[model samples]
Target: MRTQVCIIGGGPSGLLLSQLLDRAGIDTVVLERRSRDYVLSRIRAGVLESGTVGMLEKAGIATRAHAEGLPHTGTYLAVQNTGFRIDFDALIGKQVLVYGQTEVTRDLYDAREKADGIVVHELDGVELHDLDTDAPHVTYVKDGTTHRIDCDYVAGCDGFHGPSRQAIPKDVLTEYERVYPFGWLGVMADLPPVSHELIYANHPRGFALASMRSPTRSRYYIQAPVDDPLDKWTDDAFWDEFRRRLPHDSAEALITGPTIEKSIAPLRSYVADPMKWGRLFLVGDAAHIVPPTGAKGLNLAVSDVHYLFEALTSHYRDGDDHGIETYSQTALKRVWNAIRFSWWFTTTMHRFPGQEPFDQAIQDSELRNLQTSVNAQTVFSENYVGMPY
Candidate 1:
């Protein structure tokens, strides 16, 4: 099948891109290797920048989000050695909404299913073949036979390890990477959140985060070595660590529920420059990845789609390729800005491997400054709440 755009991956970026393009009268196809159920049930990002909500609103997909999502004025920063609360809203007037990526994806998926000229092929298990030529196509196995899809342009939203990056000539790409010594162990509980706002704590033991997914479900994370086996920590052990890091006036207020999910995801920052080659372009995690401390992953993907859609719109209107021609450079500016912020937040909060005494002192001093200095807080707020869209 031939189309204006062939999107590889049905995650937020690919699905959202197709939705935006469809609204603008562009033809797009979305291919996903997983079943529709898997994408709908995936527990991914839970925070959405204010700007992201606006994008979903504009796209007419905010009905369920508006009804079910929780709105928070800001977050809290606590130092375990000494209990402290640094308000993010006081630092910046903006606030973020707590909504699951699954919700947004489900909405977009449904919208795509209903929109004309938009084809969402689930369970296609598409494989990337040749991308060096002007014409790029995806070959996938369907009904026990191979099929080919042709399009005017290909978008690699599959993710970091996906085929899109492999297609790029190795010599032409420059990669910058930093792997953190620790990974985040996230858990979800069925109890109500202890605090209305999110709390991030820095303690001698390690770093911990207090966040909520809904009024009834709370999500929290603590720092652990990348090599640490999750089996070492049981449900009670997890709660003990959480209680030590997150101190509340009343221990009764602490949210408690069945230990639902546990996993260790390493923290890292990665960036690939010039996200386009020939008729193929990359967006979202496929082009860049952040540590998630700044809550920018899902938001960045939304921004990427905005720039991509604007570029495509300009390309079609008045025959000006200005937007498409400059897509990489334009998106990179925002991508790099987020990368820096995520790195700063992640490194500042989490302990490094074999951190020397001096290095630990420097990190402590920096955190103290962030708490006491208005200037430092302002910088954090801008990136935390999000930069102007």
Candidate 2:
């Protein structure tokens, strides 16, 4: 097969890129390493930055999202079970939408199918060749047959574990990473959320967050050891521990239910310099990862897609290469800023293992400042709603 752009990943980023590019008169094909069912079943963050909502609109897939997504003007932050709201609308006149990542991916997939876009699934042994020169192609095995796609450009949206980022030469790629000592043990249930808006809590026991996928489906997380097995925390144990960490009001309002999904996700802040190498450009987790503290992972992926799509469109439609040549530099600027914000938020809200007294005091001071200082809340609101593209 031959195409203008071969997107190596059927996640939201890749699909969004393909959708946008196809509408702009560019032909593209998408490749995925997993079946469509598996991808849709994965649970992920639901917070949508204002910019993400706009991107969904640009892709012409926001009708369902806008109808079902919950808009929040503010969020509650807690320190030792007492909480205060950071009014995002008051601070910046912008708010975030609580829409699940799964829903976004579903929308993208639906759009792709309606538009008859190509997305290959359950491939094996994918490889990239001739990426340094103008003509690049990708190959993978499916159904006991070897398939090849020759394309003008490759968008590596296959994520951190995929072959995209590793295809970059070791000497050329620079990596920065901080793997946190703990992970978020999250549970998804069919019960109503404890609060209408999300609540992020910091307590002596651990950090906990009250979030939701929809009004009827709640998702919650509590900080726990990275290596702890799933069996370590039973349903009763999780609810009890979660209640102990939440504010008295939210805790009292919480409704416990059997979890439909539960897992431990290790936190990490990772970035790769120069998101582009030749015609193969890294997008989303293939290039960077931020802790879920600020719900920036999927949002960052959307931002990366925005940059790359603009660049590719400029190159194709108007015969301009400015955005194409500078895609990495431009995207990384925003990516780094998000990394800093996620790092700061994660540090402030979670109790590190073996943390000294001084560290706890410092975290407490920062939380207090955010609670009482208008300037601090403004900064939080700005970052939470996302910066401009």
Candidate 3:
């Protein structure tokens, strides 16, 4: 088989890129190791930066999101149970759309189907060859048959555990990572959110976040030991801890309900430099991962897609390779920025083991500055809503 671009993932990043490229007259095929059902079953955060919303718009799949997604102009930040709002719109003239990642993937898949785009599923032993050369190809097994796909370029959107990142020579790919001591214990319930806007709270007890998927579907999380087992946390236990960390008012307004889903996600900031290796480019989780505190995981991937799509378009249309030549460095610039922000936010909001009183005081001082200083709030608002493309 032959394609202009071989995208080695059927997830949102891969599908979005294929959709954008196909619309631009670039031929591509997507290969996924898992079935579509399995891919859509994974749950993820969905705080959409304004730029991601625009990308969805350009892909013609934002209609449902715009109609049903919640739009928040600002979010609330609390310290020691005293909370204040950071108005993103008032400060930066922007807002975030809260749409679930599952829904976004579904929409992208639907768009691809409508366009008759090719997406292969359930592949085994996927491999990339000759990525350092101008031409690269991919090989995989579907059923009992082995198949080969020759393409001008390869897009490694297959994520952290996938083969795309592993294909890069160890000597060439440099990785940086910081694993936090804590994780987010989250629950999904069929109840209304405690607050209209998202609330990020810091307390002596721990850190808690009040968020929602929709007006009726609440998503909540509280910081916990990274090694803590889910069986140790019953529904009531999670609610009690969550309420304890929230501001008194939001805690009072919080309603308890049966949890539909629950899990603990470890927090970490990871980035692999030089997102591009010859004819292969890494996208989304394949190249970088940000701690969820700043909600930059998927958004970073979208930015990479934007850069790669633009670069690929330039190459095909006007024979320009500037974007391609600079893709890795350009994407890493934004990647490192988000990494720093996530690290800062996570450290400020969570209680570290063996942290001295001086450390706690510093965290308090920073939150107080954000609460009291308009200039500080503006910076927070800008980073929270997104730094810009």
| Per-model TM against the reference | 0.94, 0.99, 0.99
lDDT of 3 by residue, 216-261 (tens): 9999999999789899999989988998899999989999979999
**Candidate 3: TM-score?**
0.99
Off by over 4 Å in 1: 81-91, 116-134, 248-252
TM-score of 1: 0.94
For candidate 1, lDDT tens digit of each residue in 313-365?
A: 78776678888788889989989999999888887777676777777687778
- Candidate 2 matches the true fold with a TM-score of 0.99
> Which 10-residue window in model 3 sums to the lowest lDDT?
380-389
80-119, model 2: which lDDT tens digit per residue? 9999999999999999999999999999999999999999
Clashing pairs in 3: none
For candidate 1, what's the RMSD?
2.0
Locate the minimum summed-lDDT window of 10 residues in model 1.
116-125
Give me the overall lDDT of model 2.
Answer: 0.95
For model 1, what is the C-alpha lDDT against the true structure? Answer: 0.80
> Looking at candidate 1, what is the lDDT of residue 349?
75
Question: Which residue runs does candidate 2 get wrong by more than 4 Å?
Answer: none
